[model samples]
Target chain A: MPRYRAIIAYDGTDFYGWQVQPGKRTVQGELEKAVNQMAKNPEIPIRVQGSGRTDAGVHALGQVVHFDLPYQIPANGVRKGLATMLPFDIGIEQVDIVADDFHAQYSAHTKTYRYQLSNREFRAPFRRNYTGYWPRRLDYDKMAQAIPDYLGEHDWISFAASGFQAKTTVRTVTDVKISQEPATQEITFEFTGTGFLYNQIRIMVGVLLEIGMGTRPVDDIPRLLAAKDRQQARLTAPASGLYLKSVDY
Target chain B: MPRYRAIIAYDGTDFYGWQVQPGKRTVQGELEKAVNQMAKNPEIPIRVQGSGRTDAGVHALGQVVHFDLPYQIPANGVRKGLATMLPFDIGIEQVDIVADDFHAQYSAHTKTYRYQLSNREFRAPFRRNYTGYWPRRLDYDKMAQAIPDYLGEHDWISFAASGFQAKTTVRTVTDVKISQEPATQEITFEFTGTGFLYNQIRIMVGVLLEIGMGTRPVDDIPRLLAAKDRQQARLTAPASGLYLKSVDY
Candidate 1:
């Protein structure tokens, strides 16, 4: 048996998420089905592991995953087989044979996620699926000033969803970059961290948006962190605007 | 009756074309339906006139259209009303009251059409609907060199579709601009002409693509034009890559 790693990209509009739900269309489920059908023995089951589970409607540009095969197949052959079997919305960007010790989930050192905001009065028909539409104007300078509060190690329980089952919410965020395209009125927030609690990125984006809109002050981030209650950050940005940008090991 | 002019935008993936055909979804059909439903009296009909008919699966960024209404409605009111009645894929970018003599199709002085080509090994899922994917690399310098042959007035009959019903095949191309984004391997061809024959832009794009791919010599354009036979330029690029960029009155 050999272990193979791959980088994947997907539109995520029609998928439930990266996890395999029993009766729903999901990225993991589709990938596994394609691999099994391509394998010589149909009865032998193969499991695919992702770096992390992206919520429903969350896209991915470089999502990393790993799987073991009963027999050795060239990485390019596996890529071609999956490309032929999978739907057009999903793409395998790169495939490589990795060391036996490599694990998609446990071996990951850091991850980067991006949230896209379309701050325009009217949403373009073509961008509806990829951006979160915010008709109101935002204050970019204020948002930038507040982003540093999220840096370093902190308990982000307030930003975690109520259903999140992570044992600890303390995580170290390495970097936060905010960029705006004035011509298109699009704001993109990139966060790189060791890991994130479920729904943490969306909740953080929601709060930052409120700050940018002047509904909340910059100092409110520290207060929310101190509260450590999910109710402190009430709004959770929609999953459509979120993307798993990359995973580093 | 008052005449209203509007700049329209739409994602043409789900549309049959800009023409109204029974039992088929079309941009013109949807516009008429929205306008008539918003009218005080639905029994009295109103017709929407487009600058020209776009082929099926072709998109528009600034398509121009005009319609006459029995009563005057504020431009903002009309825009809001149509926004509610129309589907998400369609949008009225701007609306204004125009003189009674203005006609969408006849009053246009120049029309600009854009063709987007994605020259990439693998198509990104996000751009599937907006670009024509070409897996092979294109020589931008060769394509640029061949564009000058399309300038000025010429008989473009060879590029016109077989069923074209236009009275004359001689049309003047005012300008042609070819630009490539090296990072994304996307090339955009913008053509501003007095008018275009039926299927002219698509056919021109197809011929230009061949020239870029080195299958046809740069001088082949003049030969094809002199031939005056449609078979000389056989390929018609897919409608998905074409856009009605703008119409100037």
Candidate 2:
């Protein structure tokens, strides 16, 4: 058997998530089906391991995955086969043969996630699926002033959803970038960190949005971090606006 | 009765077109339903007139329309009422009470249309419904060189679809602009004109795409215009990429 590493991208509107479930349409399920068909192994399904699990309606630009095949195939052949077999919304960006030691989940060192919001008077019809709609006016400068609070290491238990199974709630966040397009009124928030707890990014964004909307003071972030209680940050942004931007190993 | 003029936007992927048919979903059909609901009229359906008809799957950014209501309603009231009644895919941008003589179709002085193409090695799944996919490298400069021929008045018979009911194929195109985004590989073609024959913009974009792909010479545009034969420019681009950008009164 040979192992292969691949980069994948998908529009997650129609998918349940990145995990394989018995009766749901998922990104992992579709990828595994394509891989098994290409290898002509209908008796068994090859398990594809993703770097992380994304919630339903969460998109991805550069998701990393690894799988073992029953036999060896050329790198380009594998790419073409998977591209042809998978659904139109899921795209196979790159494929390469990798060493047996390259585990997609364990070998990842850092990951980046982005959340987008449409800060317009009304939601634009074309962008309904790709961005979360925030009809109220947002103060960009206020949002920018609060972004630095999310940097560095912190116990993100307040931002994490209940029932998350992480060993520790502390994670090192390396960077946070906030940008807004004046013409389109689209605000994007990007976070890069060593690891993230379940629903942490969406919760953090919800806090930031409240700050932008003037409902919460700019200095409220530190208080939320100190509380270390899930109730402190209860608003979780919609999954449609969240994207797994990249994974670095 | 009071006349109202409104600017509208929509995602046309699920619509049959702008015109109303018995069983098909259409933009006009939805707008009329919303207006009549507001008017509380069950006896007869109010007629909504669009600046022009758009083909199926063709989107709009600033499509103009007008209608006469049986009773008076504030502009803001009408806007909010329609917004609440209409589906999420269609948006009412602006509304104003206009004079009784105002007509959406006859009062228009100029209309601008845009056609977009994604020129990349592979089709981006997320942008499938918004742009036409051309999985080939294109020379933007070649396309730009041929855009000047489309400016000024010309008989666009070669670009018009068969069975068009326009009295004459002659139309004055006031301006043409071509631009490309290097990062996203999105090419946009914009044409501002006094009027357009049926399917003219899509046909012209198809010719421009062929020129950009090196299949047809840049100078081939003049020959096609002179030929005045519909077969000379038979490739009508997909309606997904066409947008009625604006209408000026």
Native contacts kept, each candidate: 0.41, 0.57
Chain A TM-score vs. truth, each candidate: 0.97, 0.97
On the 0 to 100 scale, the lDDT of residue A228 in model 2 is: 88
Candidate 2 residue-wise lDDT, A65-113, digit = tens: 9999988999889998988898878888899999999999899999999
- Score residue B218 of candidate 2 by CA lDDT: 92
Model 1 spans with C-alpha error above 4 angstroms: none
* Residue A176 of model 2, lDDT score: 96
Query: Distance from true position, residue A200, model 1, in Å?
Result: 1.9
- Candidate 2, residues B1-249: lDDT per residue as tens digits? 899999999999899999999999999999999988889975878999999999899999999999999888999999888988899889999999999999999999999999988887766778878898777778899999999999888989999998887778899999899998988889999999999999999989989988988999999988888898987888788888999999999
Please report how far candidate 1 places residue B92 from its true position, in Å. 2.5
In candidate 2, which residue pairs get closer than 3 Å at backbone N, Cα or C atoms, i.e. clash?
A: none
Candidate 2's docking class is medium
Candidate 1, residue A3: the lDDT equals 96
- How far is A10's C-alpha from truth in model 1 (Å)? 1.2
